[model samples]
Target: MSRFTIPVCHVDDIDHESSKGFEIGDLNFFAVKRDGIITLFQNNCPHLGVNLEFQQDQFLDADNFYIMCSTHGALFQPEDGKCVYGPCQGQSLISVDFEVIEQQIHIAEAATAIA
Candidate 1:
């Protein structure tokens, strides 16, 4: 598959680097890191299909370890992209592949897995 490299942001700019919102090609992406591992998820919540980053850092929980869906109060773990609470309990957030190079997050590949 032809993967497009979409730039997100600088590492230093992110407070937690794990749970943060990113934008690329008019689309928003979310990232989370736990135990030194990083995972990316689309900003939209599955239940309402609404972008979770709409409010000021609402995507992040008080601990800043998981991505929370502000629309329905869904809690998602960034480790495996699983939603542990809310309407989409059994569903998972869509994963967005990315790589950090030179301290910048880039969309390493488009979500070809979806198709």
Candidate 2:
């Protein structure tokens, strides 16, 4: 139940209007940048508990508006990780607590659970 903050990347490392994957302990997570804001989430799809990206660092759809689960096409809003389409329509992506310190992105340590 304890948590720690681990630095993931610099604020500028994340591409504008895109998502980048990172790992903390054994948990996979991703960070999305949109409209000058950064959002973090667990990288697994809610429907099947699988990695969201179809390919490396490809978490967004054609328009880069939402997080898309490449495995099942589940779409989630970037700002809140809320599922807007696909099998887990009413569910949401697990949001990870993060903070920016001196232009660096730090994610709170998460449990080693994969799903």
Best by TM-score: 2
Colliding pairs, model 1:
18-32, 18-33
Each candidate: RMSD to true structure? 3.4, 2.5
What does candidate 1 score on TM?
A: 0.77
**Alpha-carbon lDDT, every model:** 0.71, 0.85
Looking at model 1, which ten-residue stretch has the lowest summed lDDT? 106-115
lDDT of 2 by residue, 11-110 (tens): 9999999989987678798989999999988888889989999888889999999899888788999999999899999899888887787788776555
lDDT of 1 by residue, 1-115 (tens): 3254656777655555446766655556766766666677777788988888646545777777667887778988778778898999989988887778777777764452342
TM for every model, in the order presented, reads 0.77, 0.90
